[model samples]
Target: MTNAGPDGRRIEEALTGGNMEPVVRIDDTVRRVAGPWTPAVHALLDTLVRGGVPEVPSPIGIDDQGREILTYLPGTVLDDVPPETRWSDSILQQTGGLLRRMHDASTSLIGGGRHVRTWRSASHEPVEVVCHNDFAPYNLLVTADRLSGVIDFDFASPGPRIRDLAYLAYRMAPFAEDALDDSGFTAGEREARLERLIAAYGVPFESSEVLRVGADRLLELADFTDARAVETGRTDLPEHAAMYRRDAVLLVGLSSPQH
Candidate 1:
């Protein structure tokens, strides 16, 4: 495939975790196909940067091709790393802390009409903060065992703080079935890591609450994925939905009192 853009700049690489939009890197900038939600996400990023939250990408103007441009963060995204590396204790703790910083920074947007702005993802009630709805390892940038940056705000929307935390716990704590790929830990490790993550966030939350919320989040995501598959004609997404459902069941079981 040709790696040159219409402007003749050499495309450095095609980024992953862009399930809906095409993303590419050029020089010190990354470009992604923009949607109606682009403006809101850019505004959120700008607000976070102005507020001294240093871990997210800086939004540049849109390109001639109608793509949103962002200053490239120089670190390896967790998706490109080995499974064991993605499951490290330091990574889990760092991600939890970074998420706390992001949520805290994003709370500033709640009162500014930013909470009701257009987003690709649906907003939930009690909008305490802007949730990076997909806070999984795939969207995290790591350097020297630290979560140095976060990317891909396409799914962000206004929601409760624990909404983001729950999704993060589901993916990082990984309450998925063992048959799936990248199911990094044994069932016994889920609660421990979940507790560790919540502790790092420095919040008072029950692990069971997180698990229950995580299950609900997964069901919502499954429906979203199924709809996207139908809209985009991506044959593989139904399987992705199935996996989400399976994981949701696991989380529900884990959250139950008998367990």
Candidate 2:
């Protein structure tokens, strides 16, 4: 793995999120393999950075290798920290509040076009705001005492707030089969934890809506990825369809309004 580029910079292969989304580190910057739509996505990120939004890995520029350059944020992404991070109250609150701020900035920007390509959205969904579409623990960088930053802007697109919140709640609140490697809270505890996060994020929602969001997104994402894999002959998510179904059932079973 060599990263000898024009900057005379040596790059190191990063341990990706269990996928082949080749990422590399060069000093404090990250270089990611980019698609044609990356230019537009980078522009959106640039806007957020200029607005002084913290916790976002602001885009720097495109490298000569055509990889998108991003300022690598320093902190352990939540998945790395595991059970302790997930169980923290302040971590949840900060994550939710950061998301709210992101949505506020995104609503004023206009960037999605029909020609732009993204796995999360086939056509530009009508926007209440551009959603991070893949907001989750793995994408969130954190310290023991603070929420540091977010990485991976690849799945961002124009969509509803709940569409984003639902997924966030699902993964962050962890309404799934093996959340925190199955060492996490019970159903009753998770339900209460989710309420605290939503209240912290300040989104209005019926308990039913939150539950529905997480479950629906799990299946919807699986379908979208499977469709892409078949259409392009790319193996996007071979195991996830089944995993999504299982999680959807898990969520559906626990649709009770209270902990």
Write down the TM-score of every candidate: 0.91, 0.84
Cand. 2 Cα-lDDT? 0.74
Per-prediction CA RMSD (Å): 2.9, 4.0
Candidate 1 residue runs with Cα over 4 Å from true position: 1-9, 112-116, 178-184
Q: lDDT per residue, candidate 2, 1-259, as tens digits?
A: 4457688768565745522478888878899888866765776687677766777878888889988898877888687786766658788888889888888787666455544434434434556776777788778877776888887878778777777787787877677555645536776677787898789778777766777777878888778767766776775364666778888877776675552
lDDT of 1 by residue, 69-180 (tens): 9998888888677666788888889989888888888887887653557887788998888998888777888786777888899889999989999988877876655323
lDDT of each: 0.84, 0.74
**Cα RMSD (Å) between model 1 and the true structure?**
2.9
- Residue pairs with colliding backbones in model 1 are none
- Per-residue lDDT of 213 in model 1: 90
